[model samples]
Target: MPDQDTSDIADIEADIHAHLAEIAEIDAVAVRVYQLRVAHPTDLVAQLAERAGLQVAEVARAERHLARLGLLQPSPGGGWVAVNPESAAESLLAPVEQDILERRITMAATREQLHALSGDYLEARGMRSAKGSIEIVKDLGNIRSVIDDLARTCASSIEVLSPGGGQNEEAMRAALPLDLDVLGRGVRLRMLLQHSARGHRATAQYVETIVAAGAEVRCTGVLPSRMLIYDRHCAVLPVDPEHTGVGVALIRDTSVMGFLGRLFAHYWRTAEDFLADPECDEAAPPEEVGGELRGIERDVLLLMAAGKTNEAIALQLGISRRSVSRLVGRLMDRLGATNRFQAGARAARLGWLASVPPA
Candidate 1:
């Protein structure tokens, strides 16, 4: 048997190793919880747990662990609250502990890749350049920090291609202060958004606010790709949809950034200016608009309300039956109605049909 001191040290080391493994798992969970809180802070813990696929018991455990680490606290009235990093010095792990935790993370990634690929070949191929680093951060807080840092360090301009509306409205709101600070210091901001995004209240508000604060906003029906470029020095791309807890590649190489910048310019040239008053009846002729019901979504709503079946609407509009069905379903969901009649009534009550006169 080992000596008492040696045996004690060995046991402690084993405990540390075990704790390191748990830390990695906890990090992933914490990130997911942070994102949930950012997006839906008013949601109860039970709802958040359900969305995260964690049992209530598991959520309770995680809550306790986070509180103990000083990363979270109970809200004054109810629910758990996140402790901002500015007020979280006590939560910072010791240097040795951090090293051990980081090592465990690297080991976990290595093990996962090795198991999946059955060799080191894929891992080697996937290793990115340290000069131009690519890191996948599953934490929303970390992603926000990275964006802020890039925005601060940008020299000239920042161009963004935003999609899917404002996924993290709170985070975007929080980022306003930082954006204003950057603009105050003379950085130019340019954004390209999907035309449909203007229909989302949160997105429209944010776009208007940013533009009013000196940022340029442009709209386009052709913008399907999401991108963010900083001073033509770095480009950030979403590795995941929902635009939360995703990886961003910080490219410093001029050649790579230049290529991305070219792609951005190409898209920009084809995009429409949101600030410019749209020309009336330019895209579709006035006579053809109502007949085809292509751009006349309101006409489809009206037809659906008239109790016409999908096949009948298709025949009347000279379009595919599938298109009519899809349009009706979309309109119903948009109006938050259970049936065609309810949808039509809701649309009328909301004055959407009245707002857009029949062509």
Candidate 2:
């Protein structure tokens, strides 16, 4: 009966070895050695090799392969033992699954970081031109549209360096509402106009209105160019300084913007306040005034001396025709003159036309 039980155990062991050998990619010698270790849990390499019909070296090699696959382990009694296949698989794959999960988490974090960076990159690209940092905006209307869009988005300040003598009535009418809107939003609006703009009736009224609305205005005899800067990060300049109706250049270059900002600061520091009295004639050096004739009156005298009619003077001065007629009448009364020619001669005699700026 004992011999029969031993025979049954050997048959079972043989069946287990055959099943393990049939598994794909596992060495046959390693399968056999693992079966032997299971049946004789505390057997040394030499005893296991003799029972399995193999040399000690072959048993040792198979033990190494099974140990790497997690199929074998050290016994407490000082030999090798077989591990359960399911436990072995879990032990072999747990660390790999954990590594894969960690990699997936890292990938998600990297994607989030890239998404945030892409938003800033796209915004910066949208603010600049495709050709680079500079863009040429042709046509006066288009330039105004660009400026309008910029004004709406300006966060801190909007600054202008206007070189022409004075704005016309039509231009002032268009600008007033926009300037008031900007000031309404609490934006710092600063304008640098030519000193001669102060003498213009229409321009003075416009300046007065905006000043009351919280704008800063200053005047100088000359300006380098016609420029509009928004928040000091972007600038628009006339393509042709002598004729600004042509086109404009939009600049976003940081170095150029810095230089332009410095230049504007220099001019702003040297310029006089717009509402202040003129320190000197815009057309000539400083001199003492001998009469009550204002700069506008002197302009009228100079135009009349050059044979400009009331219509021409009104058009040049950006004032109404009726205002020019009334002004001519007042000047005639002041000079005690009977006509336009007498008004001019008397103005010259009073030295009023000597420093009058060109119409």
Candidate 3:
């Protein structure tokens, strides 16, 4: 019974040695030296080597490695002594655990602070509730301020649709600073303008400036309304579609913004790049402005021969009423006709409607 008890004790010690060696990444020589050192704490390196069947140098190297791992420490008498692994693990890991706790606390505090600040911002902007999400600003100056604030806060993309032909020089000059600011922050700025804008010198110059500064500008003949969508989360629209200076609507409702986003996307897909030609309108043939019909102008004539209103012609040709009106005026001048009916009759008589099939 005594022999069996001793064998069991030896087996348990062997298992413990193997487990500790594997966990601590200690080699076999180091494990054996460490075990002997623990059993005979007063033994010097030479004595430990003799007992462990290793050279004195091997025991000394293992002692150094163990000391580095915190499993051994300098003894009061002189040489190193084996340390309790539980105490060593506590000493080694306490600071790491404290660092993790501190990081978690800091993250929580920052998160709380940001949330509170966001709440205040939403409340101040009158966007906290579904009903309050739409802010109506009647003053033109206030509208500009709100738009500037939105532009500054935008984190991603800004979509702008400016209709009624080219922007005037004064408007472009006023908008240049805000445009540069948006581009500087790495926010994508996309502007969609009317096709007629390309003919305006001031508009072309402004487009060149913004394009050089990383703004994406496109032009189409048609746009539903003057709209500005920021980050796909909010949209600002002119309250009065015909007269933008009347007021503006700042909409934060997700569903309405989503619809507006889709509308902008639809128009954007069909719009042409503003900088497609370096010379722009100057590259056009001389005959284009001399009673010779352009492609769009011809199409406008055909649609007008079908007795379409400016609105109907704009819809059919995917252009604005302003463009259709301009086309009709030019067609009348070319045909020497005084009224819509006279223009159509003279166009048909002059073979202008030859390509169009009879209805």
For lDDT, the strongest prediction is: 3
How are the candidates ranked when ordered by lDDT, highest leading?
Answer: 3, 2, 1
Candidate 3 C-alpha error for residue 354, in Å: 23
Per-residue lDDT of model 2, residues 103-158, tens digit only? 45765676667756744664676686653476667877898899888888888898
Q: Model 2 shows how many backbone clashes?
A: 0
Candidate 3 lDDT over 54-162, as tens digits, reads: 9999999999887875779999998888887545545544454454456457656766667556445646768367644877788888888888899889999999999
| lDDT, residue 173, model 2 | 91
Instruction: Give the whole-model CA lDDT for all candidates, comma-separated.
Output: 0.60, 0.70, 0.71
Flag the better candidate by lDDT, 1 or 3: 3
TM values, all candidates: 0.43, 0.43, 0.45
Top TM-score hit: 3
Which stretches in model 2 have alpha-carbon errors above 4 Å?
1-132, 279-359
Name every residue pair that clashes in candidate 3.
Answer: none
Stretches > 4 Å off in candidate 3 = 1-132, 278-359
